[model samples]
Structure formats: C-alpha cells, structure tokens
Target: MAKRDIPEINAGSMADIAFLLLIFFLVTTTMDKDQAYIRNIPKKVEIKTEIIEVEQRNVLAIKANNQNQLMVRGEIIADPDKISEKIIEFYNTNRNVNDLTNDFPTYTHPTKNEIEANLKAAEKELESFEEQDAGDALIDYAYSKIDEWDKMKRSLKLFGGNDFPLINSQANIRIEVQTRTQYSLFAKIQTEIEEAIFELRDTEAKRIFGESYGVIKTRYISDEEPIDKGKLDLLDVLYPARIIEVTPKN
Candidate 1:
C-alpha cells in the first residue's frame, strides 16, 4: 500500500491579505494623548539654599500612611470623595493680613511695577542699615526690613496682581506621603485636589468670562483666539492653587 501525497494550496494571496490587514489597523486605530498635570517650575540658575520657615496656620498638611489612610492636619478623613471639599475649604480660608502681630505680608492688589520699586527701596535701606554703626536696635530694624523685602518679592511672584480674593492670595497646601503608600491612593487624592481647584476656577470663569474654565482654556489655545485678559488675570488671582509637596517619609 502507498501513501497518497497531500495537495499543496496556493500561498501568494495570503501575504497580500495580511498586508491589507496591517494597513487597516494602522489607519483606523486612534492614539490618545498622554494625560498629565501641568506645573510651573522656576528657571533660575542659583538654587535657594536657605531653609525658610512657613507658618503652621498657613499650611494645610495632608498625610497618607502606609495603609493608604488619609489624615488632614491630624484629623482622619473617612471619605475620599470629601477630600476635595476639604481642600477647597482650606484653600479658600481668609487670613488676617492687617494684624500688626501677623508676620506674613498681605496682598493688596498692587501692580508688579510697584512691588519692584518697593523691593529696590528695601535693598537700599538694608544697605544703609548695614553701613551704620552696629547696635541691637539697628540689627532688629535691618532684620525686619529683610523680612519685608522678602515678603514683597514673594508676593510679586505669587499674586502677580490684586484681582484675587484675600483667601486665594494667602493660602498654601502641603502634602506628605509615607514611603509604603499606594500610588493609586496618592493619584486619587491628587486628582481630587485638582478637581477642587478646577471647580473653584470654573465657577469664577463662568461668573467673569461667561464660560467655564475648560472652554476658556480651549479657546485661548485655539489659533487666532482673542482671550479676555482682565478675566484671565482675575482667574489667576482668584485661583493660585499654591501646592507644596513634601518628601516621602516612613
């Protein structure tokens, strides 16, 4: 008995079919842009070496433990959804800038040029004090002037203008995460914070620009789009979103 030979099928069209399938996938599939949080970074060459202290009242400290449990300024927060509300409240709190006992400088909506002028005058005064004979009173005066100049400089950068509410101009946030904390929890918390900020900004945008922040930002980026500058400045002053992230610890 002899084994029958198998028939060989034609293979020329198979390669062409695969090529067409590859082309179809390449042309039809859509790619999504990578999502990210936009942040402002300083461009100065000399890094700040001083360990400046921040007031306890101005800092909204949020901590995430290894178990992903959250504590806001020593109080446990049960619901993750409520984090945004807490953040909004913390960011919107008003400080008493007019009190003589208070240390931090107040933002009174002065122009950038005015701030620059003040900084220059302060530098001159500090130099004059240094040139004078040394005394305890003179030293205290010089130190006070230094604080004033530093506060003015910081305000020039942070507030930029006076259109913002006093609450927005003065508040700051500090987040501290433990080393073993889950990335998902941290990401969610960060998202909530950003949502809270957006909610506030969007509300202001709607009130002043007659559009939501999302729409305003989109239109502002479009070609030949003319944005309302005053409204934009108002938004900046109203929602500064000052966040300070601390190093992860045990």
Candidate 2:
C-alpha cells in the first residue's frame, strides 16, 4: 500500500496574526513607572566663605537606627505615619508668632521696602563684579543673588500681603539613617516629609489662588504656563522644603 501523504500546514497567515497580537498589546498594555524623589544637587563652591552656625531651633532631624526605630526632633516616634504631622508642626509653630522660649524655627517677615533695597544692592553688586572682570564663579554668584531678590519681589507681590513671611535660611529637615536600616523605612521617611510639604503648599495655594497645589502643579507640568509658574514660586517661597538626606553611616 502506498503511504498516505500528509497535507501541508498553512503558515502564510501566522505572521499576520502575530503582528496583530503585537499591535493589540502595544496599544492596550500599560507600563509601571519607577517611583523616585527629585532633588537638586548643590552647586560646587569656588570661593571660601565664613561658616555660619545653624541654631538648634532651626533643625528638624529625623533619625532611623539599625533597629528601624524612628526619632524626630529628639522625640521617639512610635508611628511612622505621624512623621508628617511633626513636620507640619515644625513649620507652623512659629509661622504666625515667634516665641523665644520655643525650639521651633522662626519666621521672618521682610517688608517690600527691605526687598527692594536688597534687590538694588544685588544689582549694584552684579554691575561692580562685571566692571572688575570678576571670576565667572563670583559673577554667577552675584547674578544668583540678584535673581534671588527678584524672586522675592515677585513672591511678595503675589502674596498680596503687607510682608513676605519666610522661614530662616538655615532651617532644614535632616534625615539620618543607619547602615542597617531598611530601604523601605527610608522611603517611608521621605514620603512622610513629602506629604507634609504638600499639605502646607496645597493649603497656601488654595488660600491665595483659589486652587489646589496639586492642580497648579499638574497644570504647570503639562503646559508650563507662566501664571502657574508664578503661583508655584510664591508657594515655594512661603513653604520651602529644605530637606537634607544624609548618607547612611557604616
């Protein structure tokens, strides 16, 4: 008997089917983005300047030990979720009135006149540096000062108040973790700090602009509108997040 011949399988359409599936997935599938904290790196210093001491009142230190214990401002924190509240307190304690006996950071209300005077001084300094052919670093420093004053002026105008309330320049939120501390705890610390700052900014944004901070931030990210930028700048001046994350010590 002759052996039966098998029919050939059709593969001409296999490539088309595979292509369709690929296209479907490419159009419908979603990707997860990596979570991160954005921070600005300090510029390299070219000139030596006198060291200024930061008062203990201005320091809000959060420490994590190898045992995963948390301490904020020298007080042991049993709940990690409460970190944000502590941060809020740190910022709001002396915001309206300063108490000399308290250990919280104090606020400075610079008047319009003071800001204008500083702006003039900064511009004059910048011009003097240009005339003397100062080094690039010095010139840049002068320009930065001028820009800083200019920002303050804008911030004050946007504030629509008699004075621009600013926290101490030396005030900061410091995070210190031990080498054996878990990464999860470190991230939690950062999140809590972020939450606190967001709350402060959001409240201020609503009070001043009749919009939420998140809304302004999202709009700015999408369109880069100058109005939103100015609003953000004003909020930043009011509630600056001066965070310092220290490297884990071995």
Candidate 3:
C-alpha cells in the first residue's frame, strides 16, 4: 500500500531523442538511384532571334498516343521490336536532297563482314610479325592499322558531301508522345528507337574494333579507363542519338 509516494517519469527529452534518430537515418539512407538513360542536357544559350525553317521531309516524326500505340510518320507500328529498324529505314531514305538520309556502306569498309575480315587479317599479320621479331615496327604498324580502321568506322563529325560519304549532320529525328501515355510505354518506345540507331553503330563497331557499343561508349566508359577513344569517336559519328523530344501532345 506504499504506491502513494511513486515518482513521476520524465517525458520531456523523448521527442528530442526521436527527432535526432530521424535526422540520423535521413542523413545515412541513400534514396536516389542512378538514372537509366544518359540524359544529354543542353545548356541555356541566348541565341539570335531568327526564325530558321526545317523541312518536313528532313524530319523523321514519331508519335506515341495515350493507348501506347506507336506511329512513325502517319503509319502505325504494331510491334515494338520493329520500331528501330523502321527508324533506320526512315533515317536512311534518300529520295531527294531534302529527303536524304545517312547513306553508309559506300566504297569504304562499312559492312560488318568487311571490317571483321580486315581486322582478322591485320591481327594475323601482327602475330606473324611478332614471331619474326619485327620489334617496334610491327607493333606500331598493327596498332596504326587497327586505329585507322576504328577511326574509319567511328567518326566524331558527321560526313557531308565534301567530307566522307555521310549526309547532313543536322538533328533529324523527332519524338512526340501524348500527355496521358504511360511513362513506361513512352520510355520503351524511345529505348527501341535508340537501340535501332545503336544497332547500326554497334554493327560498325563490332566489325571495326571487335567490341560491343556499350563497352566503347564515353558515358559508360571513362577517359581514365583504358578504352579505345578512336572507337568511341567513330561510334559517335556513325550513330549520334540526336533525338529531340517535344512536349507530350495528343
């Protein structure tokens, strides 16, 4: 019966302790994940207020509706796998100067088989030279041979008429999606289109340097890391993902 003199427990610092714990967890936990796509954000530049016209024929228009239905130009595309191939066709179409596309595979070693054959031959020659003790001459020659082939395949600047065999280097691809379209669907379509461009460039890379497109990419691979810059530069020239996404419109 001595419960009458019990001391009251202090609750003043409980909230403060909880607040400290919350702050500790907040600071420790990493919430943001890495972004899937390599976003090439443009810098804000004040340009001359001049209206420059772009021809309709030069633009490869793609549209994704609310239902996730994909359309290239006016034609509807049912399968997502075929989207990239279609993009390639649209990009390479050359009816006239206004409607010209990247006309790869001329007299140069553009084909995968062609490039592969050349590389294999060079590699074999390099091996033979090594056996015969050609010293720095053979090593330098082999490296230069591969380097030249890689450069030919991957280019930084787009080929104009005066340059290599490539057409104009202007931005030609445009993607538009409806407002109500699911982001997932839009992302998938956009990825496929990029894959198509990547496929072309990758194929060229595989032939020239015997490596996949991802391995040689500057974004994924670092400059500090030992990567063939020649190959990366060539890939950029061959397949520049210059797609312009407009505000989602119905």
Candidates 1 and 2 compared: the better one by lDDT is: 2
For lDDT, the strongest prediction is 2
Q: Write the per-residue lDDT of candidate 2 for residues 46-92, one digit (tens) a residue.
A: 67899888899999999999999999999999999999999999999
lDDT of 1 by residue, 1-250 (tens): 8999998999999999999999999999878878977666533345356876765656677788899899887789988788888777665443324443543333345556665786787777767777875665666667776665555555445444442334423457677898998988888778888999899889867875578887766666674353344445456555667877777854
Report how far off residue 147 is in candidate 2 (Å). Answer: 1.5
Give candidate 2's error at residue 213 in angstroms. 0.6
lDDT of each: 0.67, 0.92, 0.66
- lDDT score at residue 119, model 2, on the 0-100 scale: 96
Better of 2 and 3 by TM-score: 2
What's the true lDDT of residue 56 in model 3? 61
Residue 110 in model 2: lDDT: 97
Instruction: Give candidate 3 regions above 4 Å deviation.
Output: 1-35, 45-48, 93-163, 218-227
- Least lDDT summed over 10 consecutive residues: which range in candidate 1? 96-105
lDDT of 3 by residue, 1-250 (tens): 5668678899999999999999999999989987676656554445445776765655677888888898876778888777788777754554123432543211222454555667778878888888888887557779878775556544532221223434344546777888998888777877887788878777777877777877778544556442466556656655556778777644
Error of 1 at 211 (Å): 1.3
Best by TM-score: 2
Cα deviation of 226, candidate 2, in Å: 0.4
